[model samples]
Target: MKKLIIASVIALFILTGCNKDKDILNTLNDYNISQQDKGYHFGDKLNIPQDVLDYAEAISISFGDKETSSLSIDPKFFSLGENDVTFNIKTKSGEVLQQDATINVFAKAKARPIAYEIANQYPHDTNSFTEGFELHGDTVLESVGLDGKSKILKYTLGSRTPILEVPQPSNIFSEGITLLNDKVYQLTYKAKKGFIYDSNFKLIKEFKYPDVIAEGWGMTNDGKNLIVSDGSKNIYFLNPENPSQIVRTIAVASNTEAYDQINELEYHNGSIYANVWQKPIVLQINPANGEVTGILDFSNIAKQNTTNEDDVLNGIAFKGDNMLITGKNWSKIYEVILK
Candidate 1:
């Protein structure tokens, strides 16, 4: 009878402990800060809920192995876009409760809407499924994609024929291209490899993408590091000497929320201009923290070129002081001046 009584009491204690933890979790889960459509921004404070306040003795936040006791959304404490954070709560019961959640941080200012005026037009290859584009001196460098037809080419600004064209292997689907230190860098889609070339377009070497990036979408350079996008909200800065090494990562976001499908990158005048896939819009992002500073709506230009769904605007290049844009299988390229 005594053994039976002891077993009953022990079972009751275990049940009570489980219920306590569940109740505390329920209280913490009830306050969902991430659900707020207009998320927090720089200089904002995450309001602690009354229930959490009552239940916790100490609260701490952790992001990417960095932990802080304060909940301020300072740029030093948090980054733009989605922040996956862990709340380490020391409860009044001397129990530690860890809650993992997403805290979205937006840009401080709304993205300025910029308009464009067509400056000139040039002929482009309708057969080119244009992926990456940029201009160096009087030459326009382009990278086109497809399983059997991926190639990189460079042509004069006003001409349709390429002065230099290099085709990829038949099975390789190439994506973006960039130039740094007079060497050409090109990324491959899904193949997880990148090709480097000498100034004269001779194959120098090949390297693989880091384990974190699954696919390469666009690439450009800031005179030093190579800035790459993987069709996500992230922009990865990599070492030009070693493409597999990640220098840093920034998540692109505006005042309202974070954005994805960042493609066709171009670094010019301290801003990284990017194309949002399938949308006739170009975003000017501040590379310092991935805060979107300006937006250029190219809906009319897209309408002029878009014949079917796949003919979305997907190219960005700078010609002298003006910007040049084209699309997949586009017959014409338009030069524009940003206002």
Candidate 2:
């Protein structure tokens, strides 16, 4: 009887040992929730297993060499001001992990030494509340604002003389305009109508917009689709064929708490350039996702004609490879060289 008992005990011990080995192997194999080599975007959320979460007391995030263990935000946008940020993560286990990132925040317009020269300035009518402008070859296309007074004009570069002008439907306020192929597309403020004009500035086709948003402010194109801006901080990418469908939307970054009312837009190289409504500043932004990479403070232009008080920055046009910018009621169109 003793010998039989001994054999049974020995078998039970071996079975328990095997089961423990299997559990350890399973833990080793289940690595789906393990630490990622890089951190994700601001909007990305990561889920950790309960066991991993319990093991982690806190996480340390580092940008470059500076370590920030506890960071907080009202509505977290993952930005630490104007600088591009890359980070790494540290855990309770003393293991460090790297994050592939660039921090994006509302960048304040700092007073950088003006780098570009005022190549030239052109003139527009004093009554035209110009909102957007673009250049194709030597021809300049413009959108003038205000209800019952808005229109799209095609002008000769340098001369500022209008070659063709197409007025918006009687009572609708016109806003931004852009050119794709041979057609000039124009947006209206609240009438929900967008007009397409031929190269000759003749009315070709009209499209209607749904009341998805309150106001139409600015617009540009990326050679593929139309990009529009509402007066708020948000910018929307839309399908050219279907205006209602949104491809993507991004909240613009402003240095101040005030929302930068984006008024005009121009796509140059791979970046999107925008004019702040009623302000004398332009931003060079990344369009892949909405990241404000650089800033061009044309406050000098605002200061130049401080006596007039009518010079508000409003227009941006790219001529060939050069950029031509203008202001409302200002007599000069500026040729700017982006450094």
> How do all models score by TM-score?
0.88, 0.66
RMSD in angstroms between candidate 2 and the native structure over all alpha carbons: 13.1
Clashing pairs in 2: 39-99, 85-103, 121-333, 122-332, 122-333
lDDT of 2 by residue, 237-257 (tens): 877776767787766663432
Candidate 1 residue-wise lDDT, 300-319, digit = tens: 98999898888899999897
- Model 1 / residue 333 / CA error / Å: 1.0
Error of 2 at 116 (Å): 1.5
Best by TM-score: 1
Error in Å for residue 339 of model 2:
2.3
Residue ranges of candidate 1 with Cα displaced over 4 Å? 1-27, 33-35, 64-66, 74-77, 307-309
In candidate 1, list every pair of residues with a backbone clash.
none
Best candidate, lDDT: 1
Task: Estimate the overall C-alpha local distance difference test score of candidate 1.
Answer: 0.89
